[model samples]
Target: MAESTTVDIESQQAELDTYHDEPGDRPVLRARFEHNGSPRYMLYTIKRLGLDHEHGFHLDVQLVSDSLEGGVETVEAKLQEGDADLIDIDYISTARERADGAPIVAIHPYGRTVGGLVTPEDSPIEDLTDLRGRRIGVVRRLDKNWILVRAACRERHGFDPDEEATPVEAGSKVELTRMLRDGEVEGVLQFWPIVPEITETGPYREVLPMAELVQDLSETDRKLPISTFLTSEQYLSENPDAVRGFKGAYRDAVDRLTSDDELWEDIGERLMYEDDPEIVRAVRDGWREMVVADWDAETIDGMDRLFDHLLEVAGADALGVDHVPDDMFRLEV
Candidate 1:
């Protein structure tokens, strides 16, 4: 893994050339990600696909310890100006809205699921309605889960998250888990893969899952978009072969993740800090529980709904989904 930094276009092209070992060899693909967050998951998935070796790709995973706000800003700055073959990020909608001219390669889809710190014996908060007047800890106001939770609360629960409950912002997952463990918040609306680790640490309860709640409310299939792989339009135009190769490798990773339980167990142990085997098992189980699909009509519509909610929360102009180019999501096969 190499460090990600600003590079001139020529130098970046030379870096891509390294993926090509011999004359007329396949170009090496370089993917960049902000080290600690969802993008890291994407990087690992690519690795599992064996893309680095298969296509002579280089994975450049950089750890930037900024909170959500700063992280997004850093991502935007890099995509708009930095020199990397590709950049992976969560919240594709936000990235696309900010970097309008970027070429995005949607390697795979990440469905949204929720978990909270609650005891098993506690009354199951099966839906957002049950969360009324309860304090909730969130990673950030703009987090996709927060957006979905707010929508669910408004439409299904008939309660406004802004008006009904107190919201505390935690700097990171560790801080958020601490808030839950110390009884600072009644529940925490977090993505599925993360909840298991938080619960294993203390005597917390399991509430309703975000994915189930969304299905109940919409009466149609939907999953919140968590992340995607993206690059500048220029990069994609210059290195179409590399993009295709990377996409193939990523899809391979998704297949492995979808089918192999042992692989996920290994991933859980490597990614999560909690040593409890139960937690690791729970995380693996949770990953299998959610949907992972390509960007289809239903998924896009779901994203539209999410972006609409985001606009309401941020009081900004609605994101134009029509602007998302047809080639945004790549089917590696």
Candidate 2:
């Protein structure tokens, strides 16, 4: 099944490559995304509906490898090195990089890209208090989901999970899932996209979604976006129209994805790691609530408040940055 999915992704990449073979007079906006990530669903829609062209640009999509590969060449690396024009990253990481002099700025929000704490259905653990001494698997100690979990635990439960329980860093999402299935960990903080598959197909349950924690910590009545669309400062300054065009294309694609149920059927066959009907339905529904349809000054303020809360509870070291740069967010684009 995995082999077939890989082949399908490769075939899709080949097809997308042909779309911009000529480039013509349109400015080609090069972008990179994880090979099987959720963003591709919207990107596929944009290309299929000719939203990019209609908005005045040519979309050049690059499917990137997920492996750290010694952490040399990544989506962020491509953007910093001027090899690509756009990518999405969690805002905390963006702040850290910006503090260290990376010329990237967030142009738009990508939604609350949170994960959940998953345990086997029959497991005795029912809440954060039950995680006292059990092993929890995470992609990394510094991952945003784990940080949020720690903050929520400390604030609501009166103990830091980092000190009270054992955390096993699995190095990657795939390995984290394997650790849970193999009984290497009692609970795993898994990303949202992979959560439905485990809970739907097996005896697993999400104890809590980190999104709830984000809302509670930020004191917001509505969901706030944790990740954002990013591009180099130079790219935004030089090609302002292209950046705005991509935003229009993105908004249109999101609208179509939200309203068209049949379009999800195509996404399940083409972009998803698993094509199970239940999984597809779960993903489609989740995307509707998680993707930010639009953002205004209030949205940015909500994010700022969320950042302040995380900083206050988690500390600068835990967040990897002491402060958010003044120019970190640019909604003007």
Candidate 3:
């Protein structure tokens, strides 16, 4: 709500974090989240709550890996190997991972998205129907979204992405947009976060809300995939303060972020690839769709629906279990 003068990031973090670089009495919680917007929220929390000079422990978030591709997996491995404390549940909480009987659990409700599919602005395609017999540019990986796209194609049009249409993968969003802008692909299926930038900055149009597409194809009532902080059962037990502190700070950020135009503008100017007003507004609106207050009954229900859809395509063995564990959401010690 108020203006915050830009300061040295390292010093600001140290001043805001209860657990500074110097080891403190408060347990240091080493964590990594998809830097997409998660870190921005955390940083906002530090500023909003004046946590920079607060006394307590620290939640050290490694924001080096900007995308989830490398960061989430690296954190998941570290947590499983006992080198890190927290990571996203999507990384390791698959049915198969749960079936393995590992003690990982969703420690905090971070954010959620229903996502979207976009296409080139000049393309003749107007809706999902046009996607039939066309090539689409996607991310570098066969993410869950891609899996759902395959399902949607098979059910809606009897056209399989693998056989009837081409789904090309590029290294990053920039590369993907490059291909699309250069007329290499007819359409692009991407998530919500980068879609705004794609439409506002690049040559594209946001079409086919992906959550609706996935829901139509999968018949899932609540099409939501939660982005949460997950931790080993042992770690939660060991460092209760770190867990609670991080959660409180995160909630503080989300609670205030939506209405804080100044913060949003500042964040946009600092983080976005381009600093245009339209792009900032679009990105902020996209982030707005991702924020939530709690993992209430409805939220968890949405996760179950999504998990079921994933299970059908990815299978129990591939997902690592036969069911979604109830203990995935833990609010306290």
What TM-scores do the predictions have?
Answer: 0.71, 0.94, 0.77
Worst 10 residues of 2 by lDDT: 65-74
Q: Report the Cα RMSD per candidate.
A: 7.0, 2.2, 5.7
**For residues 1-333, what per-residue lDDT tens digits would candidate 2 score against the true structure?**
246546856976875665554557888889897675567788888887888899998888988754343442267778888888988878988998889899999998888888889999999989888989999998777778988988888788888888999999886677788899999999999988889978988889999888889889999887789888899999898989999999999999988999999999987877777789999999999888789967888988888888888888878877888889998899887
Clashing pairs in 2: none
The lDDT, on a scale of 0 to 1, for candidate 2 is 0.84
Give residue 115's error in model 2 in angstroms: 1.3
Q: Name the top lDDT candidate.
A: 2
Per-residue CA lDDT of model 1 for 1-333, tens digit only, reads: 122222322333343333333323556455544433443444565554546557544444444432444444345455555545666455435445545554545554555534443433364555566666778887765555565666666665567675677778875555676677777887787656666655566566567566665454445564555565666666667777676666666556656776787766665555544546787677656665553645665666665565455455433322233244455654442
Clashing pairs in 1: 19-28, 35-62, 118-204, 118-205, 119-204, 119-205
lDDT of each: 0.55, 0.84, 0.60
Report the Cα lDDT for residue 125, model 2: 89
Off by over 4 Å in 3: 1-23, 35-39, 51-55, 66-75, 81-83, 89-103, 171-175, 214-225, 309-322
Is candidate 2 or 3 superior in lDDT? Answer: 2
Q: Over all chains combined, what TM-score does candidate 1 have? A: 0.71
* Residue-level error in angstroms, candidate 2, position 130: 1.9
Specify the poorest-scoring 10-residue window by lDDT in model 3.
Answer: 1-10
Candidate with more favorable, higher TM-score: 1 or 2? 2
Query: Which parts of model 1 have CA positions greater than 4 angstroms off?
Result: 1-42, 45-49, 63-66, 69-92, 99-108, 113-127, 222-226, 291-302, 305-333
Q: What value of lDDT does candidate 3 attain over all alpha carbons?
A: 0.60
Which stretches of model 2 miss by more than 4 angstroms? 1-21, 69-73
